[model samples]
Every structure is written in C-alpha cells, then in structure tokens.
Target: MGGDPVTHGGGAWRAKWWTQGEEPGTTGQWGVWESLGACDGGGGDGGDEEPPAGGFVVSEAQFNQFFPNRNPFYTYSGLVAALDSFPAFATTGSETVQRREAAAFLANVSHETGGLVHIVEQNTANYPHYCDTSQPYGCPAGHDQYYGRGPIQLSWNFNYKAAGDSLGIDLLHNPSLVQNDPAVAWRTALWYWNTQSGPGTMTGHAAMVNGVGFGESIRSINGAIECDGGNPAQVQSRVDKYRNFTGQLGVDPGGNLYC
Candidate 1:
C-alpha cells in the first residue's frame, strides 16, 4: 500500500487546516475536483480543455504506457487534476529529481493496486479490522466501509479522518468516496505521498526531493513490513517497478533502490 496500516498523528491534520469560511483544496471552485466524465476523456464540467502534460514529468502517453492495463477508474486526467492539491509533489528539485519522484510514486502505487487493476482491497475478510473504536470520533461510516480503497488502498477509520480532514473530504463518514470519486482517489494517494511519512523518517516526496533515494520512499510507505529484509521480495518488487518506471521516463534510477 502507499501508506502504512498504522494510524498517523497530528501533522497531517495540521498541514492543510483552513478556517471555516475558507475553501478546501479539492472543491470544484478550487479546480482540483474534476468530474469523472472529464477524467474519462469525455465532456464534463472541466470543459473541452484536454488534460495537460506541461507541469507533470509524466505525460498522458507515458502514463498510459506505464500502466497499459490500469483500471478505467484510475484516470490520467484525475491524477493530473489531483496535482493541483499538492503543487510540490514530483515538481520539486531538478528535472531528474522530478522525474524520479514521479516514477517512485507511480511505482509504489502500481505495486499497491496490482498495476492499477484492483480499486478496493481484495481481502474482504479483513475489512472489519480497519476500524479502531478507540478514537473518540469513532467510525461514523460503518466498520467495513473504510477497507482499503483508492490508488494507495487507504484503509482504517483514523486514516480516512486524517486524510479527509486534510483534503476537506468527509472520508471518515463517506469512505466510499475514495472508490466513487476519481479525483478524490488520486488526491488521497498524493496526500499520502506528499504529506504522511508512514513508518519512515520522511515523506516520500522528501525522500526524492532531498536526494535520499527511492529506497527511503519504500521505507516511508510499507517499511515496517517490507524494509530491512523483512520482506525482500516485496522490496525488490517495488524497486524493480521504480527502476522500470525511471527507465521508461528516460531517467536514471538512483542508488539505494532497496529498503
């Protein structure tokens, strides 16, 4: 998964906090929340403007080539739309760094979702385990509703609450939005990528932008279970994808490839 299974702390809640009257980043007025129709390359509220590839290191054609069998729900337009919510993601540092970060993020995402084949977690039997009633907020969305969804396969009630609070979506109460909304799904994945560090010492964005390398990004995602020989096969899987993606982007996959 793009994020660790454990609950995060106050940093994510405070990073994007806004006053009551201020608009959240993902709203239609903010231009980050595009309609699914637009994401699907059809007409929608996003207008006739084609999905832009200028700012992002990965172009639409490159993205399609990277995940040729990706699910229709994980739209390239949706990912481009979500970029507005985190301007620094994959855009930080030099061109090589930017491309490396993009490759790293997509590599982990591809692993988590099985080349973008699965939307929600396939293990339905583990659904109910995601809810932790200890949190005072409780699971307003039913115990099983928060089971892993989106590109990162975001699971758990507190995670939903934190991600929703940061992105201005009520994911805790409407966890299905991750699966139902394409833009929201990509935003959540970017949210975890740019903000939360998971079990590592730094965010995935930091690892790439700061020259810490791709292995650190893996550590930030599922290190507790996969890093330091915990699961070398999984680590290698992520590293192989990172290398493949970086190669596809015509960039070098820097050192420290395995966590």
Candidate 2:
C-alpha cells in the first residue's frame, strides 16, 4: 500500500479551529443549514436536470478531470453516481444542503481515495479470504491477507456482507466486485457515510477529519478509523490548513477541537 494513490496524495493533514481564541459557530447545526439554502431559484418546476426524485446531481467526470493524473482508475460516471446518491442521506428537500454536504464530503473522500480515479483498485488485495489469519476461511489453503476495497474501502467479512445486503450486491461472497465495479464500490461508500454516527455529524466528513479523533471519532462509518496514516500531530496539521483557509475569509476563527 506504499504507492497507493489514496494514501499518497494529501498525505494526512486537515485544518482545525483556533484554540487560542473564540471558535466558530456549532459544528453540524446552523452553519450547515445556512449553507443549504432553499431549492428553488425563488420558485419553479424543479427542472429536468434536477436530480432524480430523491437523488442529487454532480459532474463526476468534471471532478475527475480536475485531477486527471491523480485518479485514473475509478470511472467518472461512478464518481458522479456516488456524489449524487450521497446527498439523499441528508434529506430529500435539502438539495442545497446535500450539495454543501457533498462538497465537504468529497474533500475527505478525495483525501482517502487518492482522488476518485484509482480508489477502487488501490487497496483491494484482500478478498474471498474472510476468515481470520489463523483460520483463513475457505480461501486457497495458504492465502491470508484479506484487507479491504473501494473508496470508503469496505473491509471485513461482516461489513462486506452488510454492505452487500443493504446495497443488494453480495460483497461477502464476492468481495472483489467492489474493485471490479465502480458503482458497487461507490454505493457502499455512500451507504456507510449516510448511516454512520459520531460526535460531529458525519455529514461533512472532511470537517470531522479536521475536528475529531479518526478511529474513536470516525469509526461509526463503515471504514476503519485509522486516519490512513495520520496521527494527532497530523490531525492538527489538517486543522491548521483549514484554519488557514477560513482565515482568508475574515470570518470568526473557531476553537481547538476537543478530540
């Protein structure tokens, strides 16, 4: 996994709120709501391009095109699907909210997935060998390492089985499918993000990354909370980055994360 794209780019640094002074508003309440404005441009038919019924919309190809060399494995279409579907987790009417959430969510996803192009194939070495190292399931007698797969990188036989059941894909028996199919992998990621819970809302994954403990804080989501390779110093590093970003805006700088 040394050369793995997801772990390479962005390394493991995000921004945090300032600890020395007054912090910003709440983490997952008003600010996010304000960002999610009304759907209608004053009021209209909702439009054709409007995301299908409960779905949202985004240009996955365009997102990928933005980082061509970084991500070249996952399909542009699959990225788009994940982006679009991810919003439904927030709410049906909150298209704006969904979009805002999606923006924040993608930041973390990009960091974790090494962009959207190569995530599926990046770390999907462990498959079909669900049993413990000592047991080895029904694997080919000598096989042992059964790591994980996809963007959020679904792992563990239990999780794979759960993801497959919810998404109707059968990942336990066919773990490799996550790497083989971008849509399957993307859906699994979306499912995890939408369903998981924690200190701060998982709605803004990047925000959580910058604000909380990775495993203890983010493990509610389906993926392992190992922070890729980030530690507390690295977490603070990300906080510094986001703080710098917020600093340019002249808004109130937030406080240090408790975690």
Candidate 3:
C-alpha cells in the first residue's frame, strides 16, 4: 500500500481519466481481498492452460513503471484465473499473439480501474441509477451503490449476477465481494473481458485473440460512448498505455489501436 500499487499479475480500457478516477467515470480505493487460491506452478507453451508463460506482458516492475501509483486491487491469482477461465488467452501458438493478448487485455483494464487508482465507481450520484428495475435480478445490494467495481468496474445487478454465476459466486447478493476479495474482483473483469460483447461489439478476448486489434477491444468495453466519435482522447489514452505495456513486455502495440 505504501510502495507502488500491488500489481500482482501485470496489467487496461473504456473509461476516462478526466478525474484521476473512473473509466466512464468510476473510481475508488483498492481494498483487501480473500486469500489466494489454487494456481498452476508450471506455465505451458499452449494457450489452453498456461498463464502467458511470464505471467503477464510486463513484470511487476514494468507495470509499476506505467501506473506509478496504481491501486492494489488486481491480484496475481485473480489474473491467473482469468487465463484459466479463458484459455485462449495463452493457447495460441505464437508468443507475439500471447503477448499481444495479455498486454491488450491488461491495457484495457487499466482504463476501467483508473490505472488501478479507483476500485468502486467515483460518481456517487449515479449509484442508485445503475439499478435497472426491469432486470429480474433487481438490485440486491440496494437501490443504489452498484456504480461499478473491480478492474472493469462492473456495474448493475444483472452484470454482477452474470459474472458471479460464471465464477460460482453470488455477486448479486454480495456485490461487496468484488471490492473485498481480490480474486473475485478480477474474475468479474475477466468474465466481462472473455464473455460480454460490451456496448454491442465482440468480446475483448476475441478482439485480441483473433487479431482484431486493441481498437476493437475499446469497442467491446465502452464502445457505446467512447468508441467511434464518442471520445478520441479516451481512445488515445488507452492506446498510450497499451503501447507502453507492450513496449515494456518487448512486444509491438499492434495496429487498429483505436475504435
């Protein structure tokens, strides 16, 4: 907490950096998480099981180099689970592909969590508005307080439920877990990364794994407002971090860096 943020796995996406918090405007402090869980010791050459050989595109030192005062919410185990959950991240045959995927993914996460400076959303006014009463799940956490959490700052009861269901947790009922448990918090981000086609595009996982490029990833995470003609600064900000991360990892930032 004192030294540079606890960047356990390594590092990205859609929110803005306007307030030093919130991508799409969400931010908060990183919190303590539950104990670490089972993790594979030996990394593999295949993309199905391994966790990107060197774990992430950059080492802990390199990550700190980019986000100097980043938060410590993202845990190593949390990142590993992301790889395991979506083996395609490391299953590709090319190391460039692996590095690009890892780098691109984390780059996007940095934007969402505000370089890890924010955990829960910063705009308190919109907390209660996240609840979509139309959703059958409703807002179990309360009418308000779902203004994003975790690396991706996942918001809404439906999203919490979806992420929780995939990870075998009850995020809808215990949304706090995303802020309390590091693994759970990261899992939510990964779930969205590997699954949801945010805003109405392909999943970030698909964009990188299929070589669709980092720009597509932005389209996936917050394309609705940040992509296309929504905001150029946000897109470039994400690209800058991605370029920095890939460089630190000794990889190219790839083309199509914007949505």
Candidate 4:
C-alpha cells in the first residue's frame, strides 16, 4: 500500500511506507520509510487514509471477540481513537505485561458495562445523589445529569469536573458527551484507568505495570465497595472476566487475582 505523506525537519518531505502489510502509524519504529527530502514543484496525490488503530496489543477482532454482545455505541474505532490520550496504557513493560494490562482493562470494562451492553447507568433513582452541591463548581449540568456513564461508569459531579479538566472536554457542563460520543466515553474510562486510584493505593495502570497483579487494578477501581469481602461475588466476577480475557490473549492472568 502507498504511504502517508509526512513533513519533517527543514521542510523535508517523507512518505511513510509499510512492509509486510502492516497498517500505517500502527508499526511505530517497525515501519519502513523513504525520506524524500525537500518538496520540489510536483504535487503528489495521496489516497484517502483511515485513522490509525493506535497499534494497541488488542485488535478490533479480539475486542469484538471479547464483547460480542456489546452495545453498538461502544465502538472499537472509538476505543482505538481514545488510545492516543493514554499512550502508556497497554504499551508498558514486557509483551506479556502489555497483553495482561489490556486484558485486565477490558475485563474490568466488561464487568462494569456488562460485556459493554450498557451505555449509561440503568438505575435512574441514584442520579440526583451524584450531584454534590457542596463542591465549589457544583453540578453545572443539573443534579441528575451526572449519573454513571461510559465504560467505567464515571459519575458524580466532582468526577465529571476532574475528568473534564484532565481531558479538556468540559464534561462538568456537557456530561452527556460521555454517552453521546464513543471516543469521549472511552477516553473517560482510560482517564480513570491511567490516573485515578479511587479507593485503592495506586492507579489501575500502575498496578499492572508494577507487577502488582490484576486484583490491585480492581482495588484501584472499586476496592472501597468490592474488596476484602466487601462483595466477594462482585470481585470474583471481575476476576473471572480477567482470566477469560487473558486466556483469549494467550497470557496468564498473573498472581493476586483478587483484591
């Protein structure tokens, strides 16, 4: 296939060529390129290009296999698009570590959204409780708008504000974006995975990268409500999914499978 045109130092033009049928922008250092220094007078026509899949360890086919009954709204492309926001997600540590991290993440996501079937929280009764008026910013999007949404079920007015601030999306005021835009929804989940520790001692990303096991990742996400016999069934559900996903990825689920 033809390459994508890229401009480098001193106006030097280059065509990014792929070998072995690899997708563009997905190969990282594995890509081959021909450096066509300096543009002359001739114009080169470039074909329409598809967005990069971010070269994640998990492919679209694998993701589909993981969530066959997923809601159409939770698209694979959206998840790929959101990967740029968190480069270190599944790219850290060894190949096994990388696959494990991806599996762990998707496992948690599957549990949270019920195999990616639900886009937003099902219960409407808890909507008003997500709004904490005591916060200085309060709930600009109204008290009931902050109900759980996206892969991680991000909720609460304060969480919306913090996620918005971190992602530069103003989710505090436009909380619906989490449910409306698939990329935004996935980004919120990634934001929580890579940044927030929740009730745990470390972020989910840290837990996997540091070899702290998948259980710690669950702890980081919802230990306050699920860990230490708080809800063994819930914790086991996540662990079961993690093991299944890791098996699909041909990797061990690793130690500390429970929080």
Best by TM-score: 4
Clash counts for the predictions, in order? 0, 14, 22, 0
Scored by lDDT, model 1 comes in at 0.80
Candidate closer to the true structure by lDDT (higher is better), 2 or 4: 4
Which residue pairs in candidate 4 collide?
A: none
Error of 3 at 59 (Å): 3.4
Model 1 per-residue lDDT tens digits across residues 150-241: 99899889999999999999888899999989999999999999999999999999999999989999999899999988999999999999
- The Cα error of candidate 3 at residue 249, in Å, is 1.1
Candidate 4 lDDT by residue in tens digits, 208-230: 99999999999988999999989
Write the candidate numbers in order of decreasing lDDT: 4, 1, 3, 2
The local lDDT score (0 to 100) that residue 210 gets in candidate 1 is 91
* Candidate 4: segments with Cα more than 4 A from true spot: 1-54
Candidate 3 lands at a TM-score of 0.75
Off by over 4 Å in 3: 1-57
C-alpha root-mean-square deviation, each candidate: 13.8, 14.0, 14.2, 10.1
lDDT of 4 at 130: 97
Instruction: Kindly indicate the candidate among 2 and 4 with the higher TM-score.
Output: 4
